[model samples]
Target chain A: MRKKRMINKFTLYISLVILTFIFLFPLVWMLVSSLKNEFQIFRDMQSLQAFLPPAPADVEGGYFHNYVAAFQRVDLLRYIVNSLIYTIGIIIFGLIVNSMAGYALARFRFPLAGFWLGVIIATLIIPPESIFLPLYVLVYDLGWVNTYTGLIVPFIANAFAIFLFRQFFLDFPKELEEAAKIDGCSQIGIFFRIIVPLSKPVFATVAIVLFINHWNDFLWPLVVASDESMRTIQIGLQYFMNEPPIKWGQVMAALTVATIPMLLIFAFLQRYYVQGLTHTGSKN
Target chain B: MKGNDSSAEKLENERHFHQTAKKPQLKPTPPPRKKRKLKSQAFREAMTGYFFLAPALVLLGVFLLYPMGAAFYYSFTDFYILTPDDVSFIGLENFKYIVEDAQFRQAFWNTVYFSVIVVPVQLSVALGLALLINKKLRFRVFFRTAFFSPVVMSLVVVSILWTFMYNPNEGLINQLLQTVGIPPQPFLTSPDQAMNSIIVMSVWQGAGFQMMIFLAGLQNIPNHLYEAADIDGASSWQKFWHITLPGLRNIALFIFITISIAAFKLLVQPMIMTQGGPLGTTKSLVYHIYETGFNYRDVGYASAMAVVFTVIVLVITIIQRVLIKEERG
Candidate 1:
């Protein structure tokens, strides 16, 4: 019985390790193949001796050339800058607008407040894809195509952010604001001075969430930006991959470059990301 | 002297009446004036509240509501992007063609199958992982982070990486299978295996999120419940069934709904990896909608698909909500 139990534990560990490999395999392979030459990468499986550094001639000037090539081909630096601008723009706008709306919903008593909250919540159920067509038409009508303003403006005030901020603000202490109000400060002054400062944790959570969404986003950028100059990193990568006779090596190199900022951001802001997920669904 | 006394009493009564008439009837004079100031301040605060909400309201109206209305309108007509003047009433012809189209039917079933297969599998695995790591295991944090890191990785990156892994000749998946004495699988190349391959990659990347949700649910389940079960001499199976499962019902419902919706939106994976091929087995409703609208320039047909797809998703969500409500009720 003891031997059987030991066997079971060993099997469990092995299975888990294999599952992890399966999860991490693609990324690891991409990284490895990026360092290899075209022949080494495209060579049949049996011809390869093992996973090792490719021959010196095969690597030649190495992965750096591919990276440079990718950058030059798509003007990757501009894509990166465009992506940052669009993403940061949306997050800033979303934070201010959503926080204000959330603060109002949470603190104030007004006519039709509950009704409006319900409407906002209902919009969350309607997927954005459902309205992509008309939104495209709207963008075209405004002649906002290929503009950063168009890219960021449509998504600046998301219902999800409002919901998240409202949820966060619900548990905030009412007395602090009341005391501030009594101290000869106006409502706006109190909100700016006390409420905003106190809500840093939630504000960070919203910012991180918005930043991640905009950073990794592909579909909207694919649609809105027509000019190569206005192309975000995701759109640039997509165009590169499908431009013709797919360039896997260069694409991987480019993707690795494009993905690094998001990865670094995720690593840095993971605490907030995990916290937001954990706290969002919990009521008490 | 008696007449003088009576006149003095009448004068005292007259003085009392004058004082009472001079004072405010509703409130004491000092407090009534203060009350007016407080009321006006409250009104001002309410007005400022509306001012704060106005921008978000306007944006939501322009981006969400107006676009949704336009989508519905366009679904009824022949909406064209090139020539705005040429939109004509097509009635339900766009929607009707959806049923008659073979590709739409295939895409619909593909999406349904994806959800059907992925939802339960992902949920079960997530629950298992949550349970495994819920114990006091060494390196638990490392394992948790490693598993969850992919959740934040761009799906585009994940898709591209998996395409390399699904390469028939040198891919790690088949290579590993061969080492195990199993013949190589088609993986992504064969139509039969393409959707399944996508499912595997998706599950691997996504299960960690639900695992974390399950972990949160597990943590929230009080330890005293388990202690009580131990005292009652309940078996582990019984404890899990009566305690853990019931405790996680709401969370499980949430995961189910989210995973189901996400499964239907399986465009990025197929788009990057397969381009909906080896005969379009992995083609999903959303991908089809995208291609029809943008690639084929059939905006009317795409809108119809989008409308139908939206209705299906809404119906499924509503059904889940109703079922959950009923269960709770």
Candidate 2:
């Protein structure tokens, strides 16, 4: 029995290690390929050498040139700045607005609160694509085309965020607010000082989710930002490969740089990501 | 004389009793005012809710809802970029064209086929991985992050990376296959393999999310059921097949439907990797809508297609919900 158990454990470990490799392979390959020279990357597709391959004497200087060319061609710095401005703008506004709405739905005993919650949750089912056409017309009519407002306005209040916040606030101990009221604190005062401060995990979760969505959003930005000057990194990178003579090296370099910020952000805030997801999953 | 004084005191007491009766009247007045104040307070709370929701509502209405309505109206019109004044009602014609158009039909079928093949494969792999990591394994967090990292990377980045990875000449995939003496296969290059290649990349990127969902589901299952199974000498397979499978049913259904819907909207990979080509084999309905609206500037026809696509998605969602709800019932 002991020997049999040992074999089962060994099999489980072996299978797990193999599966881990399979899952991690592409990301690993991409990272290594990002460091290798064009020729080396193309030469040994299977070999581990393809990633960070040893360079011949002549190829020593090409790597920096690739990155520089990538930055120059697309104005990557501007794209990053554009992404940051848009993402940060949405997150700050989205968090405050969503939390306020959520708090009301959870705490207040207003007529039609349940109805309003239902309506908002129903919107979650209507895929955003279904509404894209009307939104474009509205933006055009308002002369918001090619503007920051056009990109940011429609997404400022997310249903998921509101729903998540409301759920979180529902379980929030009433004693905290009651104590504040006894101390002669107003509702708004207690909210700002007490409620918001206590909800750090959910706040972090919302920030990560909102920032990632806005940062990676390609379709909306594609429609809104027609000018090269306003183009986001996602859409900006596409211009490189859209031309007849595609520059693979430069495209890879640009993609590498664009993806780094997201990876770093997600890596740091992953615990929050899982936390928010758990809240949603469990509620449902 | 004393009896006369007692009578005077009684008369004074009667007068005081009359004033005491008036005190009850004041209580009724305060009740109405208190009710009015509560009503006003409720109204104020409602207004605050609206204020909080206003920003999101305006944008959602303008960009999302307006576009949806326009797509419906424009679908029936003969809209052209060149002559805005020449627009005319062409009811059912656009729909007729979609039904008759070979490429449109092919794209529609391809999307359906892709969804059918990809959703299950992706979700199953995700569940498998989730189960694996749900065990108390070493480096579980590292493994989880590694699996999900690709999901954070943009489609443009993943496509570019995978395009190289799928390169028939020097791609890692082909090199691995060559080691097993299997001839190098054209992945994205071949029309036959292009969609499959896209699916592989998509599944790799997407499975991590479903895996996370499955992990949550797995944790929710009661360990006592497995413990009971062990007492009965039930094999691991039996426990998984009976308890684990039944426990994960709702999550599996949810993931399946979500993945199906997401896969149906396949646009980015084909656009970036193949440009819907190696012969129009990779063009999806959403991409077609984009091409028509942007490339050709045939807003009217594109709107028609968009409306059709939206209806199809809605129908699918409803069907999925109904089916799953029935099963649960």
Candidate 3:
């Protein structure tokens, strides 16, 4: 029995190792192939060499010419900047607007409060894709197409963000806010001074969530912001990939650049992301 | 008189008044002329509440509510984007037209086929993974990280990467298959295999997320239950079936609904990789809707498809909610 258990454990380990390889080799290949020129990449493709960096002596530009080529070939840097602008704009505006609305629903007894909360929660069931057509039409009618305003402003007030913030703020200690009020802090002052500071984790959670969301956003930008200046990295990469003479090296390099920040975030902030994953459905 | 009320009385009132919710903070009143000041302050707070909600309400109104309303309203009429003024109130025609539309039906069936295959397989992989890693094992952390690394990639990147990998001629997948003595397969080139290829990549990308959730759920199952099962001479499979599966019932329901809803919106993969090609076998509902609305400028038909898609989502979600509500009892 003990000998059988040993065999089982060994098999288990081997199987898991193979699975890990299957799961991760694409990423490994993406990074490795980025370092190799097209000729060396295809030449090394069949064997385990595909997952290794090319020797420094073989390549003319050494390792990272693809990174330079990615930028020079297409407007990749501009797309990255545009992505950051739109994503950050949404997060900043999203956190304030959604959180304040959430706080009101959670902590204040305004007229029609229940009605408003109901409306917001109802919207949560409706994914943005379901309504993108009319939204594009609306944006077009507003003459805001291809503008940052069109990209940022429409996505600022996310229903799910509002719902999450409301849930978080409800659990906040009412006594602390009550004491702040007794000390002559106005309602807004209490929110800014006390509630805001105390709610940092929830704020960070929502911000990260929003960042992951808008950064990966593809369809909306494809429809509304087709202009080269307004293109997000996803759209730019899509166009870049499609514009004939596809270079796998530069493509991998560009994807690596696009994906590295998220990997770094997962390394550091996996706890919060996992928590969000469990509590909420995987939005992606 | 109010000042004379005990602190317990105040707590009691706060608790009782808001039975299912938390009460808003009511400011402490001074000894004299408290009621009028309290009333005025209450009004001021309510007004401030409205002020706080103003920006979100405006955006949600113009962008979310108005667009949804327009989409619903336009679904009934022959609302072409090019000839916007020529729209007429043609009741149920768009819906009727879809009944006769073969391409729409194909897209719908393709979406269903994706969800049907991807959901169960991904969920099983996730659960199986969670079971493996939940135990104390060497290199488990590395294993978890490896599995989840793909979730960090955007769908666009993954699609492009897989398109490269799925290339039948010189791609690595076929090369690996050949060494195992298997014949090379046309993955993305064939219509029948294209959706399945996309499905495989999707499961690889998505199973990691569900695995994390399942790991969480596995940890939540009390240790004593398994210990009791062991003491009762139950086999590992028996313990898993009786304790583990039942323990994860609610989470499974949740996962089922989320996966199915997301699967129904399958547009990105077909868009990037196959362009919904090889005789439109890979054409998803959203892809078709997008093409019809934007490419062909057929707004009314796309709107009808969107409405149908939204209703399917809402129905699935509502079913989950009802099931969860039943589970709570």
Candidate 4:
């Protein structure tokens, strides 16, 4: 019996290791292929050498050449900046607007509060794809296409963020607010000073969720940012892919660069991200 | 009697002073003014609540709600992008075209097929992974992170990477298959295999997200129930069927509905990798909508499809809510 249990444990571990490798393989392949020269990438395709960077002498501009070419081929820096501006704009405004609305719905005794909450939640069902055409037209009419206003403003007030904030604040202790009220703090004052500070986890949760969504958003940005200067990293990558005689090395390099920030953010704030996602899942 | 009168007068004066100092009413009447002040305070609080909600409400109204209404209206019109001034109502004509259009039908059924296959496959893989990592194993965090890394990467990047992998000749996938003594298959190029290739890539990219959700659900299942099952000599499969499955039912439903909705919006992969592909095998509803609206400049017809898509999503969501509510009850 003891030996059977041991074998089961061994099998579990072996299978898990294989599963991890399978999951990681594509990403690893991308990263590895990014380092290989185009010729080496093709030559090494059938062997484990595909996973290795080319030796120092085989490449002209070195292994980092693909990254350099990627930068030169497209204004990647500008696109990254554009992404940052858009993502940061969304997150900052999203945090404020969603949290305020969430706070009001959770704590305030007011007419139409329930109705407003319902309205916001109902919008969650409406896929952004369905509204893209009209939204594009709307933005175009407003002279917002290819502008920060066009990209950032439409997504600043997210229903999911507001819903998350409302759920978080609903469980917040009344005593904190009651104490603040006795000290002559207005509702807004308490929210800004007390509630916002105390609600860091939820804030992080909303921020991470919004950040990922806005950063990785392809379709809307693709439509809105028609101009080269206004293109986001995702759109830039798409444009790169569509460019003739697709340079596999440079493409992989650009993909790796595009993936790095998200990976870094996930690695750092994974706890918050998981918490936020799980909160959404379990609530449903 | 004089002392008693003095004390009584002092007490009355103190009461009057307290009322006057606290309220400071210049009006002759105090009670009605105080009552009005209380009423106005309530009104002020209500206004504050509205103020808090105004920014989000305004944006939602303009961007989300307005577009929904506008899309529905546009669906009924003959609105072309180039000739904006020549707009005219053509009720249900676009919808009629949608029903008759072969490309639209193909895209619609493709999306349905993709969702039908991908949702369950992705969820099961996710659940399987979640169960694996749910164990108190060494390096679980590392494994979890490895699995979830793809979820963080953009769909565009994932598609591009997978496109390379799906390359028939020099791609890593085909190379690996060759090593296993299997013949190389044209994954993205073949009309029959293109959608399946997209599905495989999507499932790989997506399963990690649902896995994390399942992991959370698994954690929430009380261990004592499993312990009781063990004491009852329940087999592992029996324990999973009775305890784990029941515990994860809600989360499974949530993951199912959410993933199905996401799958229905399958634009990026096809757009990036296949461009709706050889024989249009990989064209999705959203991809068609995008192509029609932007590429073909057929705004009205695309809007009609978008409206239909919205209705499908809404119906699914409603059914899910009702089913979940019923289950809970």
Q: Highest TM-score: which candidate? A: 4
Worst window of 10 by summed lDDT in candidate 1 chain B: B23-32
Candidate 4 RMSD computed on C-alpha atoms after optimal superposition onto the true structure: 7.9
Q: What is candidate 1's lDDT per residue for A1-284, written digit by digit as tens?
A: 99997897778677667666555555555656666656666663343332444657666785577687777777889989999999999999999999999988988877778988898888887878777878888988898988998899999988889988898889998899879878888878988899999999999999988988899888888889878899888777776666876666687787788778767776788788878777765532
Candidate 4: segments with Cα more than 4 A from true spot: A54-60, B1-34
Question: What DockQ does each listed candidate score?
Answer: 0.49, 0.50, 0.53, 0.70
Please give, for residues B1-329, the per-residue lDDT of candidate 2 as tens digits: 99999999999898888879777776444467888998898888767666655665665555555666777888899876566678899989888888888888888987988899898899889988898888887778878777777788887778877886788877788898887899999998899999999998899888988888889999999999999999999998999999999998877888888888998889888888888888888998888888877778777888888888887888888988898789869
- TM-score preference between candidates 1 and 4, better one: 4
In model 2, how large is the Cα lDDT of residue A176? 90
Candidate 2 lDDT over residue span A58-99, tens digit each: 466654666887777768899888888778889988888788
Q: Per-residue CA lDDT of candidate 3, range B120-228, in tens?
A: 9988998888888888899889999998889999999999899989989888788778778888899998987999999999999998888888888888889999999
lDDT of 3 by residue, A1-284 (tens): 99999999999899899999999999999999999999988888878888988987887875899999888988888999999999999999899999999898898887899999999989888878889999998898999999999999999998888888888889998999889888988989999999999998788788888889889889999999988899999888886578888888988999999898788888898777777766564221
For model 3, the superposed segments whose C-alpha errors exceed 4 Å read: A281-284, B1-35
| Model 3: lDDT of residue B272 | 95
Instruction: Let me know the DockQ for model 4.
Output: 0.70
Q: What would the per-residue lDDT of candidate 4 be over residues B76-122, giving only the tens digit for each residue?
A: 99999999999999999999998899998899999999999999999
Rank list by lDDT: 4, 3, 1, 2
Clashes of 3: 0
Worst 10 residues of 1 chain A by lDDT: A44-53
